[model samples]
Target: MVEQADSRATSFKNILLLIADDLGKNLGCYGAEVTTPNIDKFATEGVLFSHAFTSTASCSNSRSVIYTGLHTHQSGQYGLAGKAHHFVIFDHVKTSPAFFGEQGYLTGLIGKVHVGPDYSYPWHVRNESATRDVAWVADQAGEFFDKAKAAEQPFFLTVGYIDPHRDMTRSGFGNSEIFDARIKDIPYEPSSIKVPAYINNLDESRFEFSEYYSSISRLDQGIGLILESLKARGLEDDTLVVFLSDNGPPFLNSKTTLYDPGVRLPFIVRNPKAAVKGIENPNMVSYVDIFPTFLEWTGKTQHAPTILAGQSIFPILEKSELVPESEWKHRVFGSHTFHEVTNYWPTRFLRTRRYKYHRNVAWRLDFPFSADLYGSLTWDAIRHSQPRGKEGDILVGQRKLSDYIFRPPEELYDLDEDPLELVNLAVDEKHKERLLEFRGLLEKWQDETLDPWLYRDGVSKRFIQHHLDAGMIVPDRFDLDLENIRIR
Candidate 1:
């Protein structure tokens, strides 16, 4: 018993993960007009990843990717895991908290435990409470830290802050609530904020943007309090702290879609023991990389190359430099199957440094909306706005509203020229080579990942778990003629 305890004590000890709900890269550190001083200072004290993305834009599916080191399609977390949806992670998957528990770390989750079947994420301290109340969340975290300190046991705690996500009422981002009497909410003027280019400049959008900024400030305060607690307890140097969001801001075109505004979010890491600090990493990183990175950092990973779908960034953190000739450093892939149960817009994307390609499987159907976004004041404004020149034309950003709702089967964007993904480069004759190259890359990735969504004859036959008992077989090749799918 003594030997076991000593071994555990000698291993890399503490990990603190803070996740913000429905927040994009809207911090002062990220050049946004938001008051996120605490988070910006935290980035200044550590490494800030400039191009981190999620596999999916939905809350639970994205969290599942971060926890499992697998994409949403691989993990079977198709949509939100709220009671209404009940979409859970695949039973066989091993979650991060569960894995750490086996390593003798006391795993704790403070706020929203969204992705679960309780058995999947076996957190020792599951403190699900007033997530919007930053002060309350901090108090709970302090108590957990105190407990870990008393026991002298290594700890891994995840605090999910449910801020910036729209509240029950329309246009409410939990800003009106008095979370704590001592913590006053900072007011943001609508006219002064920089509206995201994805949404039209409307009065409703400005109102919601101001509300979102207020919630972000509250989240920043929560982070500061938690960091202070760690410092006060003398665990500041030992703990490897990480801060990121589940997905993008809760709004149309940003939250539920595979656009840059949806998938590209902020990622900051602060570890005093590591050599890297206050540096910005411009490499492309996916949420899938986080799991293997954790395992590598804690010395729990096997020497053999992992099939866990993500390479660890431990080397980059240790040397304070980009990985030499790393293919993953230049590109990342994403799979988004669903948002809510009803919001089924299956799409796959391959995002490179200079380009992004998206393959929309069900391109004919009008894009469905999440319940919250559908009821939002921003959507109301867009829905009720006057139609422009044509019959189905309404201005949504730089594109026609119909174009936003009814998308093509494939989309290619030159990220350099159109950062907001305003132009479709797929049909451009000049960029055909780039489009085909990215398309081939996306297909290769799908095959490597064994993505079951590879379809033939408009059916995902490859995903069928059971084959015919006698002689039926699924073809491994993606080259299927749509005109003639022969049954031999």
Candidate 2:
């Protein structure tokens, strides 16, 4: 253990991780709706990361990356259901707590352990639990903190809340009053949400946007409760608090898509011992870096399990003058696996500070809307109750790919000009040089990462068919050669 003077002098620094499900930059602190005083307080007091991103967009894959410090390809988690097939930080790498636990620190997790099935791992703590309710999570966390305090053990507690995620059939939709009263005045209409010109502006697209904002407000309230509990327990100052979402916001072109809203998340870290306070860092940081950062903060000596794809932001947090400019500037690479129950294909992206490039190998397949399964049920039941005609038609139609593929195989977006990714510069001869540069970058990343199915859709297609034949998995609509036909 490489104990620093300050770290050893003080009672061990406890870690409190609060993760919200499907949360985007829609809070007051992030320049959007929903007044999250607790989160805002943490932002005001801590290091606010402007460019922090998840390795993947989907929940399970992103969480796995955060836990393991490995990319999706390395971990083998392509989507939510793929949790069973992958290696998590809890499974492969030495977890922050296990290392700290060996050093006499108590560790526990509460609320939403969606990483894998009920499988055992190296750092698995039997004390951890998960729940969808916010109040219950706060109570459980309070109890855990109290227990850790009683034992006089330094602690690492993770609290995950399932909010802002698309509401399940029975899980009552967003809190209407909270949305109408607190956020309705925000001048954001479904029409105001400029969808990419290439995207089909179906009626369902507008309704989805409205529902997404409602969910954001609901999640904010849950975060407020957790923060209050921490303060009541007197663990605020001693604990190094980190507030981040598991993945990007769930929306049409975001959650499963390799875009900014899908991968970029609000990262706020508040450590009382750090020299810097209330600073907005534009450095590109990934979830993988978190493992090393936590260890470094606690004055522990440990390297990432493999060559980490992420770099630590401890220097930025401490306001160290010795920190190099190169350390802060780095491109973030993102990957996505088969989302929903179907084999919708996979995509990989590279995002620099000013630009973003996407290489969708499975460009032939349509965007799979996982919410459609639940939405169809609701639409059918309330067909007569809600608006009819085009509005209802859009809501009830099958999830199909839009006409964006008419352009080019590759996509190049100047994030500065088009944050929403409205324009594709891949075919523009003026930017051919930039397109080639990013394409080369993406290809290099794919090869180096050992992406299992990169440019190998035939391999994935065969794998899916093999699984179906062997009774390993089954789909509603089975087609061995899906590339030749449009099932929906």
Candidate 3:
């Protein structure tokens, strides 16, 4: 299924952005024991990013980063968008659809449009459904493409596949339901599937992952079907096809946490006209870079009015030579405040080539769970692994469950030494200076991003900035200590 790329064109006109829900780096291209031939073929057609990361590990928040080129803290979609969560994006935030739609491009989205206010993402065509019938989704996309062809308008279509994400039933990833005939059911043996290091390899875990693999392959079939539509329309030579996941897998350690396994998901781009094709990019690219990259692809004539925070990676994508490490940003940052309305643990992270740092604002609070993760059979495996009394010895992967829930205010891991992020170097005296360096860098980012959760003396510094302007002084600590309570 590997189609040849057209290397002659200098730029792309049509854009196809595909987002997979609750997917991690489990594809064949990423060298995992899984079935994703279509996506892997697509990777060979252009570039595969080895170290791409989402700004947040939650679905709505991560998508907001892509749509607006701003962090969740910046976009105001601090949690889930549906039901009682009811989190909506700020009206002021300029979105991708708004940018492309204004320039007379035909924009559309089919399936799983999570981030909202509805008005902010003004897609010309939208059929939001949770159906795993990817062929039906492709049919919808083809219809939009046909309309675009009829109008002779360039198209920007996003297909958000609700694949591999845990179903509301919590039993499986919609694998029991029969899908379209065009979709392939890639049934994997539970013993053959590679269990991630972050979770225990219980029989229940293996079974769930097998289901997840099938759902992922089903999602892959949709990619091929949609590409066939493009091929039929002769858009293959000039279109930019991008594929990424909203977050990590729906397992316990991956989904809601700011850990590398959570945020560092697969990001593949198949730019047909790029000078460089079939290369694995090692740069630490963030989701924020995407909006600006697409804007640049729109060309100078379109005139992007809104200034986006992410820098365009067009140079790296287009040029024959790889962008020097000095030229590219080597680190990525993440912010996670909530998953659902009830899961409010504001944490920010800075991951560099060498080390990773996490600043948990509400460290005293027990780490809350996204409902799906809580109810997952995998959680049942972990929680009931031991007898009633010995919880401390119970390990969620390598880290203890108690340590996982009750984390320190700061955590520093030399990624080279502790790639699994097991040992907390923040509590060690040897790495104090290195920890401070990363902490300062993270705080500076929080300041730059206007993050209100950047706390001092148990309160948001941005929240009390006016008070500080009035010449009030507070402790420089992240939280208040009753022992050192400030006196007015």
Candidate 4:
């Protein structure tokens, strides 16, 4: 990583990671009808990755993938980190923060530290808050930056913004609450917002989206405030800035599902060392690759865990198009187990450049909704909206309401033909070989990651492999046949 020729003298090396909660590709830079001047400015100067995807749509699991170079199923953070859910990362796994601290760097996190067992994420200065007060978060970040300068050590700070997520009460996004005066309120009207394709465009939905836009605008201001402090401290040229969202928007068909709108998110990286600037890289990358990318940036892979499941993407930091190189596979995978403790649905997926394959292990059961989505006004409108048919029907986005809840076991989508992923090509006779190839790829990934949800004869093979090894015979199939239950 060579630093390009510049007039400004670079002093310290650091990393500033900004993670926004429940934000999708609805920013002004993404060509959405939203006003985010601050974020857009950075996007103009950095590489805005158009096809970045998270390993899971659930927030905590998604964070785990970013912290450790592994998925939630392998890292042991399979669900939300709330006390009721109590999902914690495995103690044995080494997180990025821990590695940075070991290498004599000052690690700090402010606002929304969701992944825990607290010791696993041993930030040197941890000020975790859930407030949407972006200005206050910027203040804490400034103090941390000052501390790093005083200690003469490089800093690695992660600021998790709680904005843009639903207020969990209704169709609100903390707009009703008061905040620091430095946080300017950039309000939007429902008529000004354009709802995404994954959501039904209704009156209530539009109103809710307008509110979400307000929070996103506020988050952008907070980022600008923090970046200003970094520049004031003469660290702008010496730091790598990574910005992204945890998951998709908090909507019915997006949030907890394996759909593209749920996992595909806005990711931008502003590495000062890059020879080029403002490169719109089109390669598909995953959240699990984040830790490895950070490790490569800082040369901190010595103590990294041997079981890390992602490769560093730092080699192709400026490629505008997908590379034909073997190292850059142009593929990513997803793992989702739980959002809340009660919402248990294990799913895995493999996405290539043009095709996506989904394996829903719990296809027999209805997809459970997150509490926040269940109470939204958008959902209210969706349930009551009628179809113009002699036999009345309801639709969520372009998908049938029933299909959103009760899904097939195997789903394959050609994203080029169906960007919305409304068609199922898994059972199509023409794409049978394609489906089999992707299935094999996903199965190999599951085996490599040691996923417990890998199934055989309607049972988790990882849990029941002992019984089979003890001279017991079992059927070599995924689903069980009730008529042939006595097979030896």
Which numbered prediction scores highest in lDDT against the true structure?
4
Clashing pairs in 1: 46-278
Residue range 363-406, candidate 4, lDDT tens digits: 89898999999999989888866442234557888888888889
- Give one digit per residue, the lDDT tens place, for model 1 in 18-44: 999999988999998888888999998
The best candidate by TM-score is 4
* Candidate lDDT values, in order: 0.84, 0.64, 0.86, 0.88
Q: How good is model 3 by TM-score?
A: 0.95
Model 1, total clashes: 1
Where does candidate 4 stray beyond 4 Å?
Answer: 1-11, 388-391, 467-472, 486-488
Q: Score candidate 1 by TM-score against the native.
A: 0.92
TM-score of each: 0.92, 0.76, 0.95, 0.96
- After best superposition, candidate 2 residue 311: deviation in angstroms? 1.4
Span of 10 residues, lowest total lDDT, candidate 1: 318-327
Ranking by lDDT: 4, 3, 1, 2
Model 3, global lDDT? 0.86
Over 127-168, each residue of candidate 3 has an lDDT whose tens digit, in order, gives 899899999998998898788876667889999999989888
Residue 92 CA displacement from its true place in model 2, Å? 4.2
